[model samples]
Target chain A: MPNASEPPTTSPGIVRRFWWRSGQRTRLAVACAGVLGALAVTGAAGFSGDARLAERGGPGVAVHRGDSFEVTVRAVSGVDLFEGVEPGTGRVFGARVAGVSAAPCWQSQSLAVAENLLRGKKVRLIVKKDGDTGTDRLLVDVELPDGTDYARTVVDEGTASADVAARGELGPVESAARLQRRGLWAGGCTGYRDDALAPPSSTPQTSSTTAVPTTTTTTPPPVPTTTTEEPAPEPPPTATEEPGDDEWLARFEGKRCLLEGTRRTSPKGTEIVCTRGPRGQLRWQRAD
Target chain B: MRTEDHVDLFAEAVEADPAPTRVDGGRPRGLTAEGWVRTTGWLQVGDHPVSSVLLAAVAGLLWALVGAAALVTEFPVAAGVLTLTTPVVSGVLWWLFTTRLRPASTARNVDTCRADELEPGDTIRLHGSIGPIGQVVEVALDDDARVVLHGGARRTWARDDVVHLAELLR
Candidate 1:
């Protein structure tokens, strides 16, 4: 037994002090564990079965659609797991890496690459409004500390393929990776490997295919009709057509105009008709 | 001897030796000259009351139990409600601990030293929840004082609250 008056400084004293301190420490630990466990349970349940795909339409694990925030990588999944407090609201959110398409076979290696390059490092994410192909996963462009593009790096190293529809600028880098047989391009991953050999134009098929036929059918007839009808009245401007100047002037005819740091407003409900002279100087004409 | 007579004798002895003396031989191993001892109590460094800890634990366990029940009953709506309430519940518990459950100092025998005896840059501990070590940044002639505590955050306190002042042992 210890003396009552003596200061408790022995090993037993230290143990007693720790025991008293444990109450507060245990409370803090339980609080944190409780919250985290709740999140884990809910997250698991949310992603269960067919509801997993539907949950993608809801807010993401770390971010919502169109959220731009800075995050630090906590763990690496197929994409990096990042956490940051949302600006203006101070609400905490997690964000996964966006704009890279890692094939299923290459996910583990891609995750390894993400860990090697981004683990415990700060990165900025610009969340895209369109959700990822993976149900409910946020699409974000992960930028490294020194402004290196995470998706471009992944594609350049052949760890993942460039998401052409989402990240068009990475097409050239993806081609380079394929030519060098890097990453998934190394002959075994058939889907992305074949994509590398196809022309970059093939990826924009949805928009480009529709646009090409419409423009070809409608554009030629209008040019001849406009040239013939307006030839005499608009001689000075038509003489210096300069290819598409007529269409260019026509686009802004009825719009509010800004020129040389001046706002040009028409009080009489008039249109600003613009023309290019022979020397390429712009002439603004007001028409009511 | 009568109890009053014994108290008078002890008071006279204390006044005779105003300066603190070392105990045992060369300064007691853990007790500072200012009388700070490393231990957990109502006034210990970074210690929360056991009651506060119990309160937080109960709150957490309640959240977990309700969340589990919501999942079991196939009540996604209830689960969602519980999920949204978790942070608010934790924040309320933290506020309760800080504002209501924190201990107050009732120590009648609080040791004190004169402001003149302590110089600028002396380490000290305040008497309240602002515990856990601070350095005296300034000491004014009129008993006005300033201390730089945790993370260079400065605070002002009266001369009476300056409970312990001593050189920090390296």
Candidate 2:
């Protein structure tokens, strides 16, 4: 009989040990397969299409040369792979739509819409021209079995923007979607209209509009007061007060003016008083 | 003989028997009658199947083979995409299973003792305010229900709070 403190020679313990050893072997095999698979993919790609094209024409030439062909959509990767055209050379070329910009927030939805419309289905691809980077830019116009225009459908559903270099007449469809607040137009592209109306470069000068009126109004009062006090020995204090007042008013330049009030000054030279509060509201002053 | 004396004589005779007769002792092989009943009702592997890690490993190998075939057939982009994404997806699944969705241990012989049935020298795994893992040293069933843990630290627990009692396997 086995000692009570020692473990029993149980069948369950043997089964557990076998499973543990098998689990370790499985993990090692999976890791090795992953590495080998990655290497095989890279080696295959290097020996075929794009690498050959790159070597022939200084590393940036178009791999897929033909214009019009029938191809199937293999995969969707945001705006990059709008259509995947396989030109029978066993190489797949990713084709971006000639004019469409799917915003980041709408990318997944756009991909889903594209996949639903074209995945595993044959479609006619009309390559417009080589894009800026010499890759094929295609104009994919496919009618679904139910007669839905694929490219126009994506634009009309507000998933992709039509204002990307204007290659097709998708503006009207996009406009209608924006008005109806459908898809990404429904708060996804927040401030898109404002951003489009006022370009980034011109935004800072718009704040200067408020500064113009405040400077014009305050300059007239100081000029008259300075001239009247010019004969008095109080010219030094009045001169200092004018510059300080301008500096103080400059701090509230871009803020909204909730109220406006007359300016007041303190008797002591230490504090220059103003009726304006930090929140742009004017505190009322009693008559002297 | 009296009726009680006759019953005692029969019980002594049964205990003195050399054969391992059922119900001769208080419990056969130190197992309670309730425990024996549960053991008989244990689900066999064939009756109620569970997933094996070996099956998952085989599936992974098949997936890798498919990916390799795609690469050789000149669908390198598709194959490459799958190869890159598989590890990331697998890592996420591994994290989910290990950290968030770990299945509780189902070793019935180790986890089948009830709290009320705990005796002296019986160890238990407690889950409560003190911590998730605990071992019982001694138990008191007085008005103030308390247990003396392995560290000589005494803790009071409601009957329901003492959820698991560790099985003392011989």
| Candidate maximizing lDDT | 1
Fraction of true interface contacts that also occur in model 1: 0.00
Each prediction's DockQ against the real complex? 0.02, 0.01
Compose the digit string of candidate 1's lDDT tens values, residues B1-170.
23854555334343311222122223322333333322112222222223333444455556655555535334456666665665467656654544345311111123346444455545444332212233454445455555443223455556564345432221
Tens digits of lDDT, candidate 1, A51-95: 433233323333346766676555565644444443443333445
lDDT of 2 at B131: 11
Candidate 2: which docking quality band? incorrect
Error of 2 at B58 (Å): 52
Question: Which stretches in model 2 have alpha-carbon errors above 4 Å?
Answer: A1-66, A83-87, A131-148, A194-288, B1-170
**lDDT by residue (tens digit), candidate 2, A1-288:** 000011111222543333222333453475467656765665575455455542232113232333466666666666435445454643454556645667767566666656656666666665565433223334444454445555676676666666545444665566545543445665555544412312222111111122222224331111111223233233233322333434534433433221233222322222222245665443433223
Question: How many Å off is the CA of B58 in candidate 1?
Answer: 28
lDDT (Cα, tens digit) per residue for candidate 2, span B1-170: 33754554334343211211122232222222212110111111432312223333344444655565535444556766765566555545543442234322211123334455555444343331111123455678765457665434455655544344333221
lDDT of 2: 0.41
lDDT of all predictions, in order shown? 0.46, 0.41
Give the top-scoring candidate (DockQ).
Answer: 1
lDDT of 2 at A163: 57
